[model samples]
Target chain A: MLVELEDVSKRYQLGNLWVDALRGINLTIERGEFLAVKGPSGSGKSTLLNILSALDHCDSGSVEIEGINLSALNEHQCSLFRRRHIGIVFQSFNLIPVLTALENVIYPLTLSGTVNAKARAEKALEAVGLEQLMSQRPTQLSGGQMQRVAIARAIVSQPNLILADEPTANLDSVTSESIMSLMKQLNREQGVTFVIATHDNYVTGLASRVITVRDGELVEDEPSPPFTLQEAIA
Target chain B: MGLGWKVALLNIMRNGRRSLITLAAIVFGCTSLIVFGGFVQSMYDGMRESMIRSQLGHIQIYANGYNQYGKAEPEKYLIPDRDLSTISQLIESESNALVVAPRLNFNGLLSDGKQSIAITGIGIDAEKEVMLSSAIRIVDGEDLFPEDIEAAHLGEGLFNALDVQVGDYLTLLASTQDGAINAVDVQVMGVISTGVKALDDRLLRVNLPLAQELLYTSDITRMVVLLDETQLTDTAISTLVSAFEQHHLDLELKSWEELAGYYHQVVGLFNGVFEFITVIVLIIVALSISNTMLMAVMERTRELGTIRAMGGTPRQVVSLILLESVFLGLIGSLLGLLMGALAAKGITYAEWMMPRPPGSTQDYPIRVFVVPDILFRTFLLGFAISLVSSLYPAVKASRLPVVKALRFT
Candidate 1:
């Protein structure tokens, strides 16, 4: 009951022609569930994640998060949603290049008038096993370590939901496996729900539930992948 | 505020060379202004001191009918009110007044029998003159001694030009009221030099009574009163003017500033030129800062988009950009003030020998005076220009759409 999308539609203006990105989609997600959104490049998976993250909007639908109807919210309210409730991780690891790991983790804390943000940032970095790497700038950290720092930044505010778009797309298989395990462990321990859009089978294989998207429509909402990471390890 | 300043400091360091170049322009403008301003102040001080010494004793008390055109035809221009001792006593009451030296002027000819030079004579009380004009007055001969009213002090230029030595009896030729030419021989006791070239060329000095007799007018011509120069400020001029007016006589009073109106006019012209040049340099500096801010806004488009996505209103974004520019101005001002102050310090040690004053023979001592207010004003003005220059870029940055800015790559 944490999120509900009722008949969402989205379109784009390409020069003079109108292209439909997503048409008539309805979906719902409950608390503490790991949902993997799967599709190919043009299947509107990224657009759905964007709308859910409040980074973009649905043209005609009600997208609800924590009982708040996002369709009724204005741009400023959408920004507040991004700041107060939703955390995002991107494929390119959008860590500010100038800041060290600790400062990057605390960057979101500065967005709001908060108390004791330094202590909270330290705790988040510690949870990500990056307490020793807090002083290292993004360029100095390895790919897996950089992704860990981005996840730490995402979790620093203790938001109710995490939306990640192609979070493992830039990593190798081994590093990708480790990032997945870290994110899963944080989600389980903290009770924060997650929605991930990905083209990688390995990432979907690790999800508890899988929704297959094709041409902007949900084709299958299955309980689990046929081959999970747990079965692969066994 | 403190955390915001830290961000500003880091960005300034990150863009090191451009900020330094901007700061250098400010420093250049401010240093030239302070140094040139110092020169003007030095000239004004030198000119004022020389005029007080050689002529225009702080105030001149003239008799009735004497002030009209040139004291023209000295025969008719005379002070009929002849209470010199009592009036001198009356002026000595004001705490700011000093040296009540009375004077009489005459037109005559100086001759050593073989050579003759037409000259103007100024008679002074050798006992009361403060020897302020020593640069022009004779140093090689006896002073304008109190007892020697019959003796004349020849100007150095005339003494050199006429080939006359001290102790030579000079014949002064004049015309009487009956239209007959009369001649008298006067002994030369001193060689006088007024630092000014024009005054030194034809001036002769004598005792007051001697000048009165030579001019054939027995009335006291005028009383020249000297004031304590340090106390003779702008406000004191009007105070003394009204006080002298209370004396109930046909007297004329003027301050030293009034005596040098032409010099002030020249200073005004220089000030006008300096201001025009300073404004041009400032405009160049301001433009350079604006260009930097524009580049900064362009570079940080993605960052601004991120901040905007995180609940930063357009007002907040504009404020951030403007704040950065204000911070830039503040930094430039700090650097400029330090460099300008150091330049001002260096200027103070330089000594210059300028041309002799206009009416005196003395070559003045010229030194730079670093006015504190001018430095402060330069810093403030530079800071303000920097802030004004950033307004356009700040607006452009704020008006950028959040989504469009994010896609700016």
Candidate 2:
């Protein structure tokens, strides 16, 4: 198992009331599995991703990735762990506005103290079919192009897992299809594990396995029905 | 530069207007410090030179007990003519010694037959007094030459009080060393001013021989020694002290600084004002920089969260923010130094005149000296305050919770 969550729970304070964002969730993800998490709004989908990526802590129980207990690690240790092992893609495509696309892709590699960061970043951009747009800043790129840059940044370090939260929510259907195609290609060809929390049914169709979350609980976990790119696009 | 520094530089450039506003505050503060410090230093230099040239040469040598009891009984503490030659020779042995002039101080009455006024008289060595009294202004007529034994230079106030013109004769009367009254007639050669009102009102200057003849004494009060440079004053004093010990002479030496209490007072006041201004400028610059950094942090909340999620430690986040401030300080301080140096030159070139200071009789032209020490200190102050001001904001940005920061609009 690459990730194991055993009875994990998380709570949040909403003014005068305490609301449960995640409740007694138990799940396991294996290596090289492209899993999609399906849920309605405020259904603990993001909280699951947050815990898995170590961006937040679970109020109860434990989370283990690659047999290392995340609850035992401090904030700094978690950052180091994430830098070395986990890559994250945000919904808004949060590329540092000051950095060019290449620089943004090189950011995580630099953080991990990897050698030949520029070469690695270029290779990652080429993988996402954005090799020629490396020098452009985010403002100069279209939404689809920026998202591709974001995906390049995510996989530049060759992380153990990539967690994308609503990665294609802001793109149109055509652009979203292209992005989904790129991510599925990376997963199939490179055997890169992915756990994406998204609302789009098209994203779920591309994943090898799909899980649904509702009211902070896991309602379904099953293999996705085999579908072709043309069939999903139609 | 590291990735952190690169990000910091780009972030500052991203907000050009805000960065410029903060830089302007630092520049203004730094320039004010340097310019004001330079002006005060120039004033001190002027005052010190005036005091040294006008009354107190670099060093004054008096007989033992003269400073303590000479005022009450001037004759008892007089330096005899015999000892004067020995002291002068010993002082002149030092190559740095420029001139050693002897002065005899006596108080008496001056009369123009119709009017009489009490006066303080100085008997100066005619040739050496010319070099020692370089700061003394001869307002009317000419100075007394070496051969003018019967000539006197009256203070402008005293000259007017007696209603005497150049070449007019005045009767000077005083008690002799033996407690007997003596009188003499002298021709007024010049009217002088020392830029001091009270001193000028009762001042009288005459050649040494005439003063001795009038007082019926061949004794002098003290010797004033001028040096080639004021910096050599202490070295000269050390040499003179050794000579005095070797010759077994009973004498006391006072530097010009010890005699010019007013100069010390003025310097103390100026230093206090400078410190006060420094505090105010520091506060203003610190606030300006702090506000700028805080705003930058707030606007980039989501970006910072993204960085943290990408494995940037809190320390890296802080380093990025502080690096931005350091760049601001470094660039701002250098620019401020350049501007301040130019302003100092411009002000000096302008030759602006300041009104007469309190208790002074004449106005003086202002000169702003660009002291290297003041420039360096102001630069460091600006830089240091900039770094300190950003510390709080940097920490605040670093400690932000990642999930909430990511959600920040």
- The whole-model lDDT of each prediction reads 0.74, 0.91
lDDT of 2 at A224: 53
Alpha-carbon shift of residue B283 in model 2 (angstroms) = 0.7
Task: Supply fnat for every model shown.
Answer: 0.24, 0.84
lDDT of 1 at B97: 69
List the candidate 2 regions with Cα displacement exceeding 4 Å.
A224-234, B111-117, B156-168
lDDT of 2 by residue, A1-234 (tens): 899999999999999999888999999988888899999999999999999999999999899999989999998999998898898989999999999999999988877778999999999999999989999999999999999999999998898899999999999999999999999888877878999999999999878889999999898998654334433655
How far residue A35's Cα lies from its native spot in candidate 1, in Å, is 4.6
**Which 10-residue window in model 1 chain A sums to the lowest lDDT?**
A225-234
Q: Which structure among the candidates has the greatest lDDT?
A: 2
Please tell me how candidate 1 rates in CAPRI terms: acceptable
